[model samples]
Structures are given as C-alpha cells and as structure tokens.
Target: MRLTVRTNIAMRALMTCAVNPGKIVRKAEIAEATGASEAHLGVVINQLAQTGFIETIRGRNGGIRLRLPPEEISVGRVFRTFEANTPFAECFSARDNHCPIAPVCKLRNSLDTALEAFYASLDRVTLSDLTCNNAGLERLLSLEPVC
Candidate 1:
C-alpha cells in the first residue's frame, strides 16, 4: 500500500533521530538530508511530537530527538500513527458501506490477515534494527546528504 509523503518523511526523520540517539538533529538539517521540504516537515514534526514519537527543542543549538529509545519504538506503532486509514482494499474499510460484498467478502478477511502479518513483521523490528550500520549510514549520509 502507498503511504502518504508525510508518513514517509516522518518515518525517515524518526529513524534518523533513532540512529543519532541523544544527539539533537535540526529540522532544517533533516529536511535537507531527506530531500523533503522544511515547510512540510514542520507539520509532520508537529504530529510526531504530539504522538510522543519525538521531542522538540527551541532556540539556538536546539533541534529534535526521539522521546523513547529506538528499541522501544515499534515499527508497527510508527506505521499506525503516521499511516492512518491504510486499508488494503475498499472492502477492508469500516466506512465503506457502499461495497455490495461487504457482508460476505472473504477477500476482505484474507486481506486483513495479510495486513496483520505485514504489521506483525514490522512490529518485530525497531528503528535500531534499521540503523545497525552506523559507519555505513554516516558515510552514505555524508555522500548523499539526503538519506
């Protein structure tokens, strides 16, 4: 399923913060690094902060940092929070009352199972799992500047 740009960017920023841990990373730097617009990232950052994923600091030498440890931040939680309303099909939506097969659609049930499996797989991993290669990540970020 396709995720919104906001979700994608927010996940990246959160993972970046996870990689850096205690180090505060500026939003401008995040935007530049991720090739996302600072204006757009502001909104995502606000949402992430509200959802308790990250904390924001103001003034000079201020930036954002993950509120919880990377290992404690489940990928499933991130996906659910940022990628809301992610139904695999029309029949999977609770509000899709217009679907004629809604009452007896086995496909929807199967899809639900598949989606659950997908989420469960993600749940098994954490941001730290994604950032195991610190040196490689630093080199890549240095070269690309937009990881």
Candidate 2:
C-alpha cells in the first residue's frame, strides 16, 4: 500500500522530535529538514498533536515535542490513524465501489492480508527504534550541531 504524503511527513516530523527529545522542534526546522511545505506540516502537526502523540507550544517559545515516550509511540498506530479512511482499492470503498466482482474478489482479501502484514511489521518498530543509534538520521533531523 502506498503511504500518503501526510503519513510520510508525519513520520518524519515524529522522528525529528524523537531524535531531539526534551527539546522543542520548530515547524520551520522540520519543514526545512523534511522538505515539506508549511501548509502540509501545519496539517500533519495538528493531526499528530490532536492524536496525543506530540505536544505543541505556541508563541515565541513555540515548538513541538513528543507527549509520550518514543518507545511508546507505535508506527502502526500512526499509520492507521492517518490512513483509516483511505481505501486500498475501489472494492475497498463502500461508497465508490463500482467493481462488478466485488463479492468474490480474492484480490481484495490478498490486499487486505498484505496491508495487515505491512502494519504488523511497522507495529514492531517505534519512533525510538527509527532513530536509535542512527547518526545519519539524528544528523539530518537535528538543527543543532551533532556532538
């Protein structure tokens, strides 16, 4: 299943925060690092914050940080949150399904299995796992000099 831009950026944003835990990360910095537009970052950030994965602070000291520990934030949960309403195919969507063989479509079941495996794989990893011991990721996401 192709992940949406939101999912990609949301993971990036979370990784950015995870790598810099205890420090608040500005949206502009995240945008600069991930190459996401402010508009896209704004929407993703709001969704992430609303879901209680990350916390946001406003004003001059404004920035974002993870609310829960990185290990507690499951990647599968994040992916599911953004992709809950998204359908894998036309047959997957109840309102827009025009396929004639929707009843006997083995393809849908196969796709469902594959999608479940995908999430299950992601479920094993967390924000901390994504950034753990990865100097490159830490370097890429960090606004401060790598020590």
Candidate 3:
C-alpha cells in the first residue's frame, strides 16, 4: 500500500517532534530536515496540530512541539490519524460500492488482514523506536537551529 505525500510528511514531522519533545521546531527546519516541501508540510502540520499530535505557537519563538511524550506515541496511532479514510485500493474504500463481486470477494478480506497486520506491526513500535542516535539524523539537525 502506498501512502500519500501528506501521510509521509506528517509522519516525518511527527517523528521529528517526537525526537525533540517539548522543543519548538520551525516548519522550515522540519521541511529541510525531512526534504519535504515547506508548502506541503504547512498543511500537514496544521492537520497534526488539529489532531493533538503537536501544538503550534506564534511569534519569534513560535514553532511546533509534540503534545505527548514520544514513548506514549505509537506508530499505529500516527498512521491511524494521518492515514485514516485512505484505502489501498478502490475495493477497500467504503465509498466505492460499484463492484458487483463485492459480496463474494476474498481479496478484500485478505487485504483487510494484511492492512491490520501492518497496523499491528506499527503498534509494536513507538516514535522512540525511530529516533535513533545516529550520525545521519545528527547531521541533518546540525544544519539547522533547534527551536
């Protein structure tokens, strides 16, 4: 299943905030660090903020910060919030009811199981799991100022 760019950027922004919990991070800095478009990230950031993943502030010291602790934030929760209402295929969507074989289709069940498994795996991991003390992330953050 392919994730939308919004989902991708939202996840990155969330992870970045998770790694630096309670620390304000500029949108431009997150965009630069994640290589996501600033314009696109703005929308995702707004969505995340609305969903209580992060809070935004205004002014010079204004930026974004996680609303909760990284250990308490699960990957599954992120996906559910950012990726909700999205489906792997047309058959998977509730709006797409034109399929004549919908009642007898085994593929839908199989896909549902696969999707559940995917979420289950994500549930096993938290934002802390993705925040490694690796050189790459350090290098990325080093190029920008941490708010």
Candidate 4:
C-alpha cells in the first residue's frame, strides 16, 4: 500500500524533531531540511500537535518539540493517525465505496491483512529507532553541526 504525502511529511517533521532532541525546531528549519513546503509543514505540524506527538508554542521564541520521548512514539501510531479515514481502495471505504463486488471481495480482506502487517512491522520501529546512531539521518535532519 502506498503512503500518503501527508504521512511522508509528518515522518520528516518527526525525524527533524528527533534529531534536535531538546530544541524547539522551527517550521522553516524542518521545511528546509526536509525539502517540504512551509505551508504543508504548517498543516502537518498542527496535526502532529493536536495528536499529542509534538508540543507547540507561540510568539517569536516559539517553535515545536516532541511531547513524548522518541522511543515512545510509535511509527505505526503516527501512520494510523495520518492515514485515518483514508481508504486504501474503493472497497475499503464504507460510505464512499462504489465497488460492484463489495458484497464478496476476497481481495479486500487480503489487502486489509497486508496493510495491518505493514503497520505491525512499522510498530516495531520508533522515532529513536529511525534516528539513533544513524549518521545519515542526523546529517540530514540536524540543524546543528553534526560532528
């Protein structure tokens, strides 16, 4: 199953925060590092804050930081939050489904099972798992000098 652009942006934002640790990372910094637009990052940042993953502040000194520890933030949970209400296929949507074979589509179940398995694999991973001791990600995500 393909992941949404929003989810991709969200992960990039999370990784940006993870690499910085205690810093209140600016949206512009994240956008520059991840090559995502500030407009799109703004929307995703609000969603991440609302979902209790990151905490935000206002004013000139304001920015964002992870509310939970990096190890505690499950990638699966983040994917679910962003991907919620987004059906993988027509048969997956209850209200919007227009599939003619909706009554007995074996493929839908298979897809669902596969999707769950995908999430399960991601569940084993966390922000820390993605960032820790990873020279490449730290180099890319860190706004500070990575020695």
Candidate 5:
C-alpha cells in the first residue's frame, strides 16, 4: 500500500499552498520545498490544477494558489484523484495478476478492507487539518506567520 512518489509530491505541493493561502507559490519554490525535480513537479502541478485543487496563473508574475479553501480539500479525495489507476497489490489488477488462487484469495479481500480503512482515515482529514497550528511546518517551508 505504498504511495507513488508523484502522489507524495502532490500532497506536499498542496500543503505548501495550504500553509501559504492567498499567495501565489512559484513552481520552483514548490520543487525546492518538496525536494522533487522541477520537471516532475511541473507535471504534478498541472495535474493538480486540472483536478480543481489549485489555480495556475501563467505570465511573468504568474504562479499557483489553492483554488478552494484548505478545509474544503479532502486528503482522501486528492489521494483518489492521483491514485485511481494505482493497484495496491498485484492481485488487485486483473491484467497484471498471475496468481492462480486470485479468484478465491482471502488475502485480496483483506487487503481491500485495509485499503478502504486507509482511505477512510484519510477522509477524516483535510488540508487544513494537516497544516493547523503547525509552526514547525511553517518554518520548514519558510512561510510567513499567518496574521
């Protein structure tokens, strides 16, 4: 049930925007903060924008910002948007599964339940929940104190 590097980057980018609400964050800054390559961050940022999670302004003064309030962006929803095609286990993917017992495998069902529980827990948290009252995160990201 490991998350892809891209999914991890997307969450970091979103959290960067969440902590610095109302300001346009540069892609370079996000790349720097998240420790993702600029090229990779570019793709993830575009995907995030297209998914209605963030807004992008293209120009000399352009950058990115959260399209919705932090409280409105569910962590689970973001995860689903990027992870829709990700198979948790080889048995989860019909095209990739070669296990002979897949049809009657109890492990698959157990893994499914575990995956659902993972998402269910995430569903309880929003971007705001991840960033609330976290001064250390603000410092690490170099965000100004929210007034």
Candidate 6:
C-alpha cells in the first residue's frame, strides 16, 4: 500500500526527535534535514502533537519533542493515524465510490487483508528499531547538524 506525504513527514519528524532526545528540535531543523516542506511539516507536526505522538512548545525555546519514549512509539500506530482517514482506492471511499462492480468485487477484501498484513509487519517494529544504534540515521537527523 502506498503511504501519504503526511506519513513520510511524520516519520522523519519523529526520527529527528528520537535521535535528538532532550533537545527541542525545531521544525526548520527537521525540514532542512529531511527535505520536507515546512508548510506540510507544520500540518503533520500539529497532527502528531494532537495525537500524542509528539509535543510542541511555543516561544524561543519552543519546538518539538517526542512525548513518549521512542521504544514505546509504534510505527503502525502512526501510519494508521495518518492513513486511516484516506481511502485506499476509489472504491474504498463510501461517499466517492463509483465502481460499478462494488457488490460483486472480491478484490477489496483481498486488498484489505494485504493492507492489514503490511500494518501488522510494521507493528512489530518500534521507533527504536528504526533509530537506535543506527549511525547513519543519527548523522542525518542529529540536532547538531551534519557537516
């Protein structure tokens, strides 16, 4: 299943915060490092904060940080947060479905099963699995800024 730009931005922001533990990492910092648009990042950041994935602080020292430990954060949960509202296919949308075979299509069930399997696989992985001990991710996402 294809993921959305919002999910991508959310993961990058989460990893940046995970790698930078105690620091209040700025959105510009995340955007610069991840090459994500600040405007899009702002929307993702707000959603992440609202869903309790990350916390945002206002002011000079303000920025963002993970509200829970990285190890406790589930990638699947994050994916679901950003992906659930979006229909997987044109036929998947209740209001927008225009498929003539909706009553006879068995493919939707198969697609749903496959999607759930994908999420289940990701559910086994935590943020720590993505960030911990990974020198490459640290170098790129560190608050210290890569040279």
The alpha-carbon deviation from the true structure for residue 101 of candidate 3, after best TM-score superposition, in angstroms, is 1.4
The clash count of every prediction, one per candidate, is 1, 0, 0, 0, 0, 0
lDDT of 5 at 35: 86
lDDT of 3 by residue, 14-112 (tens): 777765655789998899888999999999999988988888999999999888777777888878887777877778778876788988989989988
Model 6 agreement with the true structure over 43-89: per-residue lDDT tens digits: 99999999999999999889999999999999999999999999999
lDDT of each: 0.80, 0.92, 0.82, 0.93, 0.89, 0.94
Higher-TM-score candidate of 3 and 6: 6
- List the candidate 4 regions with Cα displacement exceeding 4 Å: 145-147
lDDT (10s digit) by residue, model 1, range 104-123: 87887787788888888989
Candidate 4 local lDDT, 38-133, one digit each (tens): 998999999999999999988998999999999999999999999987999988888999888889879988989999999999899999999999
**If both were scored by TM-score, which would come out higher, candidate 1 or candidate 2?**
2
lDDT of 2 at 37: 88
Candidates 4 and 5 compared: the better one by TM-score is 4
> Which candidate do you rate higher for lDDT, 3 or 5?
5
Give per-residue lDDT, candidate 2, residue 46.
Answer: 98
Evaluated against the true structure, the overall lDDT of model 1 is 0.80
Q: Candidate 2, residues 65-137: lDDT per residue as tens digits?
A: 9999999999999999999889989998999999999998799998999999999998998888889999999
| TM-score against native, each model | 0.84, 0.94, 0.87, 0.95, 0.93, 0.96
Q: How much does candidate 4 score in TM-score?
A: 0.95
On TM-score, the leading prediction is 6
- Give the backbone clash total of model 5: 0
Candidate 2, pairs of clashing residues: none
Predicted candidate 1, C-alpha RMSD? 3.2
Better of 4 and 6 by lDDT: 6
- How far off is model 4, as Cα RMSD? 1.2
Lowest lDDT block of 10, candidate 2: 138-147
Better of 2 and 3 by TM-score: 2
lDDT of 4 at 13: 97
